[model samples]
Target chain A: MDGVLKIFKFELHNLSRSKWVILYAVFYFIITYGLFQFESSQSRVVVSLMNTTLLFIPLVSVVFGTMYLYHSREFIELLLSQPIQRTTIFWGLYMGITIPLSLGFVLGVGIPSVAYGMNKLEDVKVLGGLLTMGVFLTSIFVAFAFLLSIRHDDKMKGLGFSILVWFFFGVLYDALILTGSFVFADYPLEKAMLFLNFLNPIDIARTFLLLQLDISALMGYTGAVFSKFFGGWMGMTTALGVLVMWTLVPLLVALRIFRSKDF
Target chain B: MKSVINILLFSCFVLPLHAGEITVHPGDNLAAAITLAHAGDTILIRKGVYSGVGIVINKPLSLVGTGWPIIDGEGKGEIFTVMSDRVSFEGLEIAHAGLSYIKENAAIKVRDVRYCTIRNNRFRDNFFAIYVSNSHHSVIEDNLIFATVKRNTSTSGNGIHVWKSDSIRIVRNDITGHRDGIYFEFVREALISDNRSEDNLRYGLHFMFSDHCRYVRNTFRGNSSGVAVMYSKYVEMTENVFENNWGPASYGIMLKDINDSHIRGNRFANNTIGIFAEGCSRSMIERNDFADNGWALKIMANCDDNKIFKNNFIGNSFDVSTNSTFSYNTFENNYWSNYTGYDLDRDGIGDVPYRPVRLFSWITEHQPASLFLLRSFFVTVLDLAEAMIPVLTPAKLMDARPSMRRIL
Candidate 1:
């Protein structure tokens, strides 16, 4: 336990010294406020927040996290040589990345949302969406960075692979799904689409937030079908469950990989 | 004792059972008077300017305005707080809200209200023109909202805003000179149609991660750019006209990170770029017209597997420009005015494949200064050579089945 705690503190201290987290937080805050102000309609705040979170947060998380792992390779090696177990080092790094990013999100995006959301009770839905998305993305990318780190000794290649992973999950995966739907138009793949949607962290966040916004109608048939099975509190709960899993699965996989690696 | 009992029974029968109605003239206190009204009451305001603090309604009532009553915020703070259910405020002009970068202030706001109607009102010079949050089954229609011009550093407001609300029908609203015409965040099952949005500094309409929305029959013209659909799925857009939106890196319509949507029967005409789609997939683009643009459709290589079919592409200098091969996307039965293919088989489809983009188009995108040589013979020769040999451009970038007749 002491070993794990030591690793955790060491990792967090290293993260705090980096400039990227502060830059990301400040930029996010400014951009969030700017975008919110750009919207003359108050209702757009939630949608804008969702957009910012889905697009920028994950990208930021993946890039910074992947780079962090690769840059700290020497440190990771040193930690592995110490009295601590590899699992502790991995978990420590994971927690280290997640905490600052999540904190940055809270101070950056979360604070503005709260200030704006006070009179609007529905603003809480947006707040909820942001927090969930921020945490989910932090966990996901931190684990992903670790996975990539273990695969290659080179930092650039590992970072490159992490980016490719983002592209696959963020962009290509949806395109493939779309092609499938087009090719198999008559097939009963609607349910399959729902299942496929869960494969991406962005989709889970989108579904959860959209449901909260009560704008499921925009989702067309997929949202409708999702609502039928998972709408209301139950649907939201299921989405939350999925989000939790999105975090846990990757971390678990990375942990297993880190435990037995020869490095 | 017998007389008193009879009188009590008579009083109960005689008293007005229907909800009361309050009338506010120019100098009257609208907020204080509203508190006096009962449920299902009507607050009828006659004309003239009434400036003060904001008003919050917490009852089921009809708040009617005649002669366009004005509620001036006087730069005090946030205005118009509505916390009730089934409340309606109509036919008023609201303006001059104080700036709060920390708070989302509005001229007329409906928060946590169900079945509310905000119609026939004009919101001018407010941070947020009309703010609706956590409300459902509401109608916000036929309002004229003009927002203040935003500075580059200023955190200005939107014309009509809906956040975390559901089942809203936002129709026939004229929102101009603001940042965003209509902005929806975390809103669901809403119909945003038949609205005219123009001359905004930013997008005409913007929605993020909001699902199951249908945006139809809306005209987005002469804005910085037109509408932006980002990070949401299951959207259906039909019969929307996106025109005259000319600027650097601007388009009639832009889709970023969008998935599984239908964009049909829309017209993107006379913009710098008609449609700029990036990281969007599985969306159907059918029966649309792209005419007279610098570029008709700019599909970035990052996206894949979208279907562009049965559309008319006319008079655009460049029909499409992309870096990668158009591998995942299928473009068929589209009439391209620039196409010069022969149909010897007497079939409606052309016998030879027709390339939608010219090689010079890519050169222009990378080097804007080269646009001066657009009509030069050398450029024409290169385009013709590239078209015949297919050396520079991707072979998959051609429309295999080019329709002879326009299908609109």
Candidate 2:
């Protein structure tokens, strides 16, 4: 545990000096500020920012995580020569990447929303949900990226696969679900649709955030089953638990793969 | 002129002699005094609480109270029932009338009476405040009606209810906390103006099967379903403000199966749906302002020949949504805030046409759960793609001449 903490602190210190992290935070702030200035309605601002987070956050996390792991191959090999456990190295790296990214999201979007008079209790809940989902997505995608880096020796192939995974989860999965619903129009596909929604992390985050917004447009949809399940505390907890699973499963797989891999 | 003055003096002296007056105190029986009074007489009640139930007035007389004498029914039955013509009731605080599912009980019930005036009265904690049935030429004005108990749909009644009555004028009244603030059924040629009706469980103002009615300058807010004008013809609704009527099935004004009406200069704000029209035709809907509503105008496909022009649609979630592809109603020269077309000729009209309906609205119409996907990037992309190729949505539903600026 002491080794893990030291490794974590060391990695965090190194990340704090990186220019890309600062640039990412600055970019997030500019876009969120732009969204707030462009639209006066808070719900519209939330929805727009959520879209940006869902698309860009995963893309950046995956690509950056893979690139960082590949570029630090020599440093990682040097660390392997030390008396450090593999789990400590893995968790330390995971926390180092996720915390900074999560902080970037919070400082970027969360601060502006609070500054613009979103301090009401309900608004805080919505902001918290958005930030939490962003962090979870960051963690999951980073872990997946680390896993890919550990499994592959070629840097280009690892980076390409990471981008492909982000595209599949972020955009293509929803398109496939929509097509499946249309093709199976004659059958009762509500259960199947909900099950498919759970398969994608982006959809889970979107549904959870949408349920928090509780706008009439979204509530008026004919899918009562989804709303009925997701509109309560029990459903919210379950969805959040699933997100936790999504974060843990990839990290655990990456840890296993890293422990057995030969330098 | 000399003979007319002499005759007016003679009639004034004789009218006082024929029209007598009776004074009833708090302890005195109001019913007994009312029975002793003749037609064209005045019964004056002092300022005190009078406990009574079902005080029936069978003669033409004026029931005047000084300093707003209270008439408490003690939850028995209707308070005052006017069964004669030329009756006037004023300056009374009537309360606690009974609730009966079998009988339509009210604080005041005027039946088969003509030329009666019910004014300057305060009614509280009653099932129905003032019910005018089978009466004509009645004036219900300047009254304050409120309900204390929160009743549901089965138990609550309207504030001012007019049924089978004609030429009734309901003006300058403040009503709240009833099922409906004002209701008219099978009544014709009525005028409803300058009334403030708010916080009702159902519609603020409801009219059904009534023709040639004019509603002007009324403010209705915070009702369950807002105002509904149905099955009426030759109606004129002007200068009314419908606001804050919000719910899943709420709207500012719902017009169903109506024809040949004029709805002009109305302000509809912050409602779930601004105007919902179904099976309405031959109506002129012009100069109305719709702002911050969920859907500005939901015109069903069955509505035809209605001209909607010069209206401002601002900040509504969906401007105009419909169920079918065929639109016979005309939408021309309306200023839509969502309109993106440019005006190169500078004629105050956009060169390109604007379509109010979106492909996402059509999809949500079928699958309501898809509303969660609203304002998503994928949906925006889908909308732009659908606009490029008009395949699924109604092709002809376009405003050919969209206004460049808002038409106030």
Q: Candidate 1, after superposition: displacement of residue A60 in Å?
A: 61
Can you tell me which runs of candidate 1 are displaced by over 4 Å? A1-263, B1-16, B148-155
Best lDDT among the predictions, by candidate number: 2
- Against the true structure, candidate 1 reaches a TM-score of 0.58
Question: What is the C-alpha lDDT profile of model 1 across A68-110, one tens digit per residue?
Answer: 8878878888887877777777777887887888888878876
Model 1: residue B120 alpha-carbon error in angstroms: 1.2
Q: Could you tell me the lDDT of residue B30 within candidate 2?
A: 89
What's the distance in Å from true for residue A217, model 2? 2.5
Candidate 2 residue-wise lDDT, A1-263, digit = tens: 78778777887778878778888888889888887787656776776788788888899999999998898888889888998888888887778788887788779888788888889998898899899889888888988888889888899999999999998998777667666666776777767766777788888888887666543333233435667778778878888888888888887888898999899
Task: Report model 1's interface C-alpha RMSD after superposition on the true interface residues.
Answer: 18.7
